[model samples]
Target: MSPAQPSAELLEAAQRPFPDAKAMPPSVYTSTAFLAREIETIFSKEWMCVGRSSSLAQPGDYLTYELAGQPVMVLRDQAGALRAFSNVCLHRMSTLIEGTGNKRAIVCPYHAWTYGLDGRLRGAPFMTATTGFCKDDYVLPSIRCEEWLGWIYITLDRERPSVSTTLAPVADMVSDYGMENYVECFRETHVWDTNWKVLAENFMESYHLPVCHADTVGGHSKLSEMECPPGLAAFNYHWITKEASLPIGNAHPSNTRLEGRWRKTTALLALYPSHLITLTPGYFWYLSLHPKGTGQVAMIFGGGLSPEFMADPRADEYVATLKTLLDDVNVEDRGCTEKVFRGLNAATARAGHLSYLERPIYDFMHYLADRTTGFDRSFALAAE
Candidate 1:
């Protein structure tokens, strides 16, 4: 469990077959070096989920994020295209925008430099005096951004495959859910006092639900009813079938797209590198994680409803109820994940064996090893 050997230990655990697989070494969660390696090999190269595409429905609608220390902006352009660009201003290197809002133009707060919705430099005050300055010469550099099944994903690495290609398994698995039509109702961001992977691993499995979420989402959860199949190369997933604790967690009465067990089924998806989604029949919510060093994680949390529920007469009531339920769920998760981090940092902390219910965590460990240590392991798990 020495910090110096975390990657090697992680690789060994990641290569172990299921049922005999042990938990990752504690140092993997507490080591700064391991985290730095992940930032380079994982976050920099992976397709990161930003939020729902519906959140940027109008021209100039924008949201900003810091991806692996690089500021990025995703916005809807005047031409009705979803675009991603470097948020740093071209002239003075100041951030061109702040927070989420609809902007007529991207204007730098430090100077009067302005860019159009398409990122073309449009104006600069008193810049005529600058030698060899041409307004047309400056344009914010673009980053790769794509929309797959209603989610917006961006990446800094151009060599990475398209989000659609990488996450096709997820799309096909949830095809019946019509995830693209699920509208986003809200989005929020928070920084939690835990390693990003700790929060991610917590979200990847439901074994802790009975204890960690006893006051909120755990009441109706039956561990035996949850399915933890092996994960695909791009993501890991599990299923739960039950009578939903909330009405909207099941299909809305008007929904005709789902049949039989699917009407009451929910899919918990961990899209690698750090996008976790809980997609129910009538609603969906997700978390996009970014590490702030090894001790804190920045999270983008959001959720929304399917078309059937959105069109229902009690749509407003359903939204309110869903929001409150999610808030409660987050409170429980934060407490649980933070406690795990504290334990991970302890001198006596050690990894234990993984239960059958923690298959996703096992798959995730492989992903971490694959990225950080260049451990070549096949992750194309067949569906059971």
Candidate 2:
């Protein structure tokens, strides 16, 4: 199908009952025009998870991201408050900073315009002589930013629901985990050769684990043990209980909060548009994804130890073990999703039936249909 072809058939199929649902059309995964529509209607309007609040522990710590093609920066100001602003320099429009790091002020590499951590312009060399050019006239445009359960989120849409409100059910579901107390140990970014949704759907379900992740996490996952439930409005989630492959995946001896199954169970959450999380009793890891056209995805991948594990004497070894396991799992996911994207390009390709295990993907299709096609279907629970 051409990139601009409408996905009416796929949208129609999404409304069917779970037992009859099918995978979304291949065109939806390979369409640049569809991706552009999603950027405007969904990504631009929703709260996007950037990283853990714990990642920015000090004043001057900052990170940059591109949201719906807009450059944005999130940082800790001198007053110890978290703030998000347009990363573009007000003077020449050059991006104020790159990647992640700490600095006393944001300096424009293009010309030397400098802004304080509060995003107030402080210096601009040789521009003072220009007509009415006052540094006081400029301040970086602020973006809506908030922290909930220790995760930092930013949105371009000022009127969107607050993260806390939208994700309250999720917070309640994992309440005993005390997510806010988790400490980030590392974060990294990577670009993958697959459609963003392909990767997201992969994360949302475990049916593929025994096959795709056989070398890493597969041996630890049993499909029959996975719980695929109906999703809520802002997200879709499922659960699984198994002996953790990593010792840290289970509760620490010090943790008294989680009872029986929860100590061994993991919650896999797919937060709409694109944040995916795997929360275990002793650790958490996530992927915050942004699309690069229809065929590639830019991902911020990070994870950390839960408070109980962080306080353990073996914290350093646990961190290393978690990182290594996550790295291996990511490699398997990259290969699997890339192949799916390639298959999507074939002339004979068509979507087939969705397994009960892929219920999250079914909900995700309804979400896309709602935004892109003006479909009136509602995924919200009466109360969550």
What ranges in model 2 sit over 4 Å off? 1-4, 379-384
Question: What is the Cα-based TM-score of model 1?
Answer: 0.97
- Which residue window of length 10 is worst by lDDT in model 2? 375-384
Q: Report the Cα lDDT for candidate 2.
A: 0.90
What's the alpha carbon RMSD for model 2? 2.0
Q: List RMSD in Å for every model shown.
A: 1.9, 2.0
| Model 2: per-residue Cα lDDT over 1-384, one tens digit each | 443465676566766777878899887887777888889898999999999988898999999999999999999999999999999999868988999999999999999999999999999999867998888999999999999999999999999989999999999999998888988899999999999999999999899999999999999899999999988878999999989878898999889999999999999999898999999999999999999988999999999999888988999999999999999999999999999999999989988999999999988888888888876555432222
lDDT of 1: 0.90
The lDDT for every candidate, in the order shown, is: 0.90, 0.90
Clashes by residue pair, model 2: none
Q: Write the per-residue lDDT of candidate 1 for residues 1-384, one digit (tens) a residue.
A: 333499878877777778678889888988888887888888988999999888999999999999988999999999999999999999879987878999999989999799999899999999999999999999999999999998899999999889988888888899999999998999999999999999999999999999988888898999999999878888899999999988999999889999999999999999998999999999999999999988899999999899999999998999999999989999999998999899988999888889999999988988888778877656423312
